[model samples]
Target: MDHNISKHISGNFNQELENVRNHVLAMGGLVEQQLNSALDAVNDSNAELAKKVEHGDYKVNAMEVSIDEECTRIIAKRQPAASDLRLVVAIAKTIADLERIGDEARRIAKVALESTAKDQQGLLGNIDNMGRHVSQMLHDVLDAFARMDAEAAFRVHKEDAKVDREYEALTRQIMTYMMEDPRSIPKVMDLVWSVRSLERIGDRCQNIAEYVIYFVKGKDIRHTSQDDIERDIIGK
Candidate 1:
């Protein structure tokens, strides 16, 4: 219902477009699982799980390549116009963002592999909380995409601010740890990088939310203020 692909004269064309959309959702699900596992690996200091996450990055990359090819084929074969074209373009952009998010997840998992001492586990608590917040954002944005709901996408866009605040707080905490005992600087820095990855993942999720708005509303809301995004979505 969200997509108007059924309006096409050729049933095959409709099925092709539907297939592309479904593949994108499948890729999103894979990225979500990767992110959650990476966060768990960090929280539990499970090096084996972290390694699995790292190895799984190749699968995400492969999915991106495969989806990009499918989109290109659709554009060439169907010559889709208007909203159909917008849907394909948005799918392309969304997959690219999802691929980057996977890379960030891999980076976060590496932190667990490098710094898993018992003393440093205390710092992971905040990261765990922030990770959950970001994970929910990704999940919600993907749901918005599934429905082509601009309002839901805008709401997810607003959530990036909260993630930013959490990142700032975590940075301060890491700095405190470093200043209190210079000996822990190296290990603390590793945690800092993991927090940074989570922050970047939040940013990537926001980008995908923007893509959803672009597809549904036919407006590019990137680099716009939150108030402007709300007005644009609501006005439509």
Candidate 2:
């Protein structure tokens, strides 16, 4: 949490804001766990675990609603200004992304449940590797948001490109496998969809990182070039 917002403030306004931020972080933690479980289901081919991930999504959804309501209440009652308003707005947007990420995790879990591919060790390994990267990106962005660190957020933004490259590689490999073995098409297609979900998760993480930058600097860097973002963040 950023102490700058709470400093010198009296009464419960700061406390309420802090509570909202904490709830968002808690929601983030749950989503991260859901993502990890979904990946485990893929690597182990455990349908039961995938089912668990699906069921766990309800919790994430509930938290998102709860946090959004709290933010709205704060806005109605307190009408914060400047950085305080930025904090609330950023958190509101972040939870929305988190909810979508949860949805993608559930989709990946469904893929795991449906896949019946044999001799998919190589494909599963690629998915596991991609999962790790996206998972780390999620963790890093959440931390950046909590600390209000724009520089850390920029680092996460850069990592998304690497994830995109890995996703492209996985797609190519899956396509080659499908071409060589028509019988494996069904299973390969499921893996392809699962990787697609993971790639989308990476994209969402990048979105959250951009929100962190916005929260910290009050700049909307969406659709801006990387060079421009670099210059803006570094004050060049």
List per-candidate RMSD values in Å. 1.9, 1.8
Candidate 2 deviant stretches above 4 angstroms:
4-12
Cα lDDT tens digits, model 2, 1-236, are 36544542335587898788889989999999999999999888899999999999999999999999999999999888877788889889999999999999998888778756667888889889999999999999988888877888999998999999999999999999889999999777888888999999999999999988887778999998889999976365
Judging by lDDT against the true structure, name the best candidate. Answer: 2
TM-score of each: 0.94, 0.94
lDDT (0 to 1) per candidate: 0.87, 0.88
The sequence of per-residue lDDT tens digits that candidate 1 reaches over residues 17-43 is 778889999999999999999999988
> Which residue runs does candidate 1 get wrong by more than 4 Å?
1-12
The TM-score of candidate 1 is 0.94
